[model samples]
Target chain A: MPIACEETGRALTVRVEGEIDHHAARQLMEELSRRLDAALPKSLTLDLGGVAFMDSSGIALVLRAYRRMVALRGSVTLQNVPDQAAKVLKAAGVDRLLPWNE
Target chain B: MKPVNEAKLTFWSRSANEGFARTAAACFAAQLDPTLDEVNDVKTAVSEAVTNCIVHAYPDQLGLIVLRLRLYPDNTLEIVVKDSGVGIPDVDQARTPLWSTGGADRSGMGFTIMESFMDAVKVRSRPGKGTTVTLRRRIARRFPG
Candidate 1:
């Protein structure tokens, strides 16, 4: 699996270890939703450190999680975003909305 | 006049093909010796265009998507992504941010991303014909300002 999740305290940490394109996003959505529903944590922290690239598909995935977290009255944090992926988020003017670290 | 270099790719409209499409376009543009940032911009544009085709063009079915990459004599790169699926009814509404027919998974920022990453993005579509997105960007060597 390209996605790994762990429930640490009040935050659900998800580490994606590959490209975040459409193909990967599909599987990611399933896993993420399961975790988000299984336990409604106060926060969802996505470690994009391992993501080599991202596109609108990845952005779509992030948006899905963001919406879910919002519904749960939680927040989403994107950490260690790669340059290519960051460029995509910045172009969409969403670098701030996601509360990214790098 | 013919372009200095060009490549055309046709792939099945599976969600899996989106990343392949982007990497392929980036490799094609790499021949121009563009800056890493320029290459990233092209990749982002390709990603948005191709994702739109897979998600919107054939919303319920699978189809073929075509990508065309051409490098001109003026260091400008042009990318064209086309799909034979359903066409957009209103290109204007489709281009708006957060305006999505793709339900929950889409950001509705496909056109915005393409336009922001590339110099220009033009869309052409008819009711049942399909949609074609043309993106052009001029890459230049960095100069100390």
Candidate 2:
């Protein structure tokens, strides 16, 4: 899995590619944590456009990111979630907490 | 055992494999006349169960993770995920929500997700032996629009 982060003003956009499963979840979390710690953006936007698949492990990642951003007094948004991934997220009621575009 | 119209794959005990497993399950379920929602649920549930095995089953040694999927004649799909690693000490506590033995971050939601999405989920484990998770989903015949 590859995660690229770009900071546009106060919003930090993260582009995640590949699968987000148990093995890859930790690495992705660590990367996000590190970047969040360093950049400390006021808002975090995740671009899931390139994400091919996501499991429950992906939900944990999303929850962790959401909570962290909330603690930082920031907001989290998801964009371009795949249909399969969106289904899981919606089932988990994650969409209720995090706003998503398409 | 010969798989009944089934497909199997093995991946390194890694997270990327979880994605592979989910995609495989989705594709396999799509072969039936189920809606996209049903297929997604099967995929998510399988992924959750498999991910649990990857995270908890093998701690030190990295071994093979086997995903066996079979499409039954009754339009029911069964997925069996096995890991020959350290098994769960207590099956009861493991299934409890927020009862993670892996500290705070881990919410112990794996079994919960499995139970929620699939029609049936069976977990068998023995400490120092291994772990196997069986998930089943039945797809109802869709009516033509």
Find the candidate with the highest TM-score and give its number.
1
Candidate 2 lDDT, tens digit per residue, B1-145?
4445988878777766777788788787787878877877887788777777766886665778999889987788999999888999899889886467654345467787788888998999999888899998888877634
In the order shown, the candidates' DockQ scores are 0.69, 0.38
Clashing pairs in 1: none
lDDT (10s digit) by residue, model 1, range A1-102: 788888988889988888877667778888889888997999999888998878787888887888899999999999888888888877676786878886
Name the best candidate (by DockQ).
Answer: 1
TM-scores of all models? 0.91, 0.81
In model 1, the Cα lDDT at residue B119 comes to 90
Cα lDDT tens digits for candidate 2, A1-102: 489989989899999998776767778888989889988889999999888767766777888888889899999999999987787677678899888987
The deviation in Å at residue B23 for candidate 2 is 4.3
Q: What is candidate 1's CA lDDT for residue B9?
A: 97
Q: By lDDT, who's the top model here?
A: 1
> Which 10 consecutive residues of model 2 chain B have the lowest summed lDDT?
B98-107
Candidate 1 global Cα RMSD: 2.3
For candidate 1, write residues B11-55 as lDDT tens digits: 999987888898899899888778988888888789889988888
User: True-contact fraction for model 2?
Assistant: 0.41
